[model samples]
Target: MEFLAVVMLAVFTAGYLVLAGADIGVGMLLPWLGRDQDERRLVIASFAPFFLGNEVWLVSAAGIVAGAFPGLEHTLIEGLYPLVVMLLAGWVMRDMGLWLRGRVDAPRWRGWCDGAIVAGSWALALAWASVLGSLLVSAMSGGTGLNAGTVLGLPLAALFAWHGAGFARWRLPEDLAARAARVPVRYAVSGAVLVAVAVAAGSGLSWSDAAAEGSALSMTAVTTAAVLPLLMAAQGLVWWTFRGRVESPSYL
Candidate 1:
């Protein structure tokens, strides 16, 4: 029974990682993908359509955590007020940026709205990475949420930002898309490597539970389910996108 519970929680975590990671990535990457007016607008269009769907996992996971593993929720989220606040703020800004950017008439106003998206993306990625660091270390010792805004967290944010940039680069006008195609491949590879290491660390953490012998395989299978599609998509993008050539008339 306990084993099933652990497996479910692990699955939830994996789901959240891939979906929410892309959400945050969209926010972070959008800022740099557009070099000018029309290009930025195209970049925004690239992600605005699908980003909302990413929230389903977060909503479902929250319900599961609150209902099934209520105790573990307390263990993890306790004293983590700042991260929650940061997360909420980011979500709001990103969404607002998505909506308002389109509505605004002035280019400058639209840019500000887009900038909000960048901030939201930046914030979300950092918060997630900080949480990962806490999970890895089993402690949020540096004043809990207050210090989640650390240098380490920033790198995670940078990665997400880069990820967002890739989305923008690919989705935007041909000239900008060409530039972005070059970057997404590298960022996707790095994000995958980060996940691989985290999976290794998680496997190492499970070493003490000799009785629960199946956890290693369970974790491996669950994680592979979440990441393999992403890996394949990235590989395909690299193979298909020749010399950063933007495929126009749209066949993504």
Candidate 2:
């Protein structure tokens, strides 16, 4: 039952990470990708359908963590309280930016909304990475502060940017799409390499250690090792299958 619960938690985490990463990436890239007000609206429209849905995954992941691993939750809340607060604040700002950016009439207000979106998204990403870093380090070393885990934020954010760019390329028109696709390839390559290195180095413990015992961390490591490749493959296939500009006149 614990194994099953952990597996479910991983699934929820992946869902939230991938979907929200892309959603946040769009916001992060908006200033650079969009040349004008109309272009910006198009970028926003492309992600509107999935924005709220993506966030649902996050809520689900949190619930799973709180319910299934209360000890872990307590540790995280205790160690990374400030980051948790920032993450919530970032989410609120990003959500408000999404909603109000469209409703307000002034160009200045739209700019402010755009700024909020970018800032909020980056803050959420950094906070998440830092928290995860704190969790991993604390678990392994009995340490109570940030370490290499905190540095994972950059690559993780880049990964999200890559996912967002791929999404934008698939959904947006011509020049915008091409531009989006070009930038993310670099980010994708760098993010993947850096993230892999970070995870491997930070964990310190070997695969054999994880397999030797049946503890929660061990099961998580084993499950992650087994499932991550499959998930990446699935994500690759999905991207390949959907790779191309949509012919629709409207964003769905």
Candidate 3:
């Protein structure tokens, strides 16, 4: 049960890193990828169909932690409280930007929304990197400082931008795709690396020590395992339905 819980957490974390990372990356590079308001709308359109769905993986990962590995959840939250707060704030900001961007028709309103999107995306990427860095350091060494996070955060954020560019290459039209092409890395490769990093981080953790006891662990693991397939199916449906490249602005 402990092993199953750990695996499920890793799966959801990796899934979020690979799937949502693309959109987050795109959001980070919104200004460059979109340029004009119309172009920005196009760039937003590219990943708009999938962002909300992608976010579900993050929520699921959190659920797994809180339910199956309550000790780890408490540890991570306590140790990484600031980063966690930043992550949630960035998430709310980005989602608000996406949701409100189309609600108003004025250029200024749209511009502010775009700025929110970009800033929030960058914040999310940096916060995740810092969190991962802290975890890696704590796992490998016995340190709890932000030094590793500070050192690792920028590079990981850059990787996020690169990953977004790769996604843009596939999702955007020719001109915007060309703009995204500046990154020079394939989306699949970058995404795979992101997933690998997440896996490595999870593997380094002491899950056996951190998991819930007895029935709590078993029930949470079983429930998550049962629900995962349904979540995957729903995700698959969304991806398949919107697989085609965006030709115009979406409702975002």
Candidate 4:
């Protein structure tokens, strides 16, 4: 059960890093990827279909931590409270921008929305990097200073941007794709590498000691086993449905 819980947690976390990373990266590079409003819309349309679905992975990972590894959850929440708050704030801001951008159809409103998307995306990336950096540092050095891990935040954020550029090259239209491809990296390869590194760094943590026991572990393991297949199936369906290059703006 403990092993199952750890595997599930790793799977969900890696899934989010690889899947939602593209969404956040694209949003982070929206201004560069899309020079004008129409272009921006097209760029956004590229990843819109997958963003919400990708978020499910993050939620599942969180649920796993809370249910199957309550000790780790408490430690993270206590140690990384500020970063968590930043993550939530950025998530809300980015989603609000995406959901509201098309509603007004006004230049000013859209501009604000665009700014929100960019800012929120950046915030999310930085916060995630900081959290990961902190964890990596703690695991490596046996220390718990929040500022110690922040040194890696900028570099990790750059990795996120690179990952986004790769995604853009694959999803955008010909002209935009050409622009995005200038970054010179393969999307799948970079994403895989990113996920691998994150998982490896996380593997250094003391998960066995932090995991829940007894009923809590059993319940979480069972629940994860039941839901994971459905989640993967749904994700596959969505990806298949929108596999083609996005030619125009989406409802986003």
Q: After best superposition, candidate 2 residue 185: deviation in angstroms? A: 2.7
Cα lDDT, model 3, residue 200: 62
Model 3 per-residue lDDT tens digits across residues 84-184: 89989999999999999999999999999999999999999999888877767676775444556545655677778889999999999987899888778
Error of 2 at 192 (Å): 8.1
Higher-lDDT candidate of 2 and 4: 4
If scored against the real structure, what TM-score would every candidate get? 0.67, 0.72, 0.96, 0.96
Residue 188 alpha-carbon offset, candidate 3, angstroms: 1.3
Task: Evaluate model 1: give its lDDT.
Answer: 0.56
Model 2 agreement with the true structure over 167-220: per-residue lDDT tens digits: 677678787888897774543443354345344333442222222234655454
lDDT of 3 at 219: 95
Candidate 3: worst-modelled 10 consecutive residues by lDDT = 142-151
Ranking by TM-score: 4, 3, 2, 1
| Per-residue lDDT of model 4, residues 132-192, tens digit only | 8887777688745475876675468777888999999989999999988889888898789
Q: How well does model 3 score by local distance difference test? A: 0.86
Q: How does model 4 fare in lDDT?
A: 0.87
> What lDDT score is found at residue 174 in candidate 3?
87
Report lDDT (Cα) of residue 29, candidate 1: 61
Model 4 scores a TM of 0.96
Runs in model 1 deviating more than 4 A are 139-151, 165-174, 184-191, 197-252
Q: Model 3 reaches what TM-score against the true structure? A: 0.96
Better of 1 and 2 by TM-score: 2
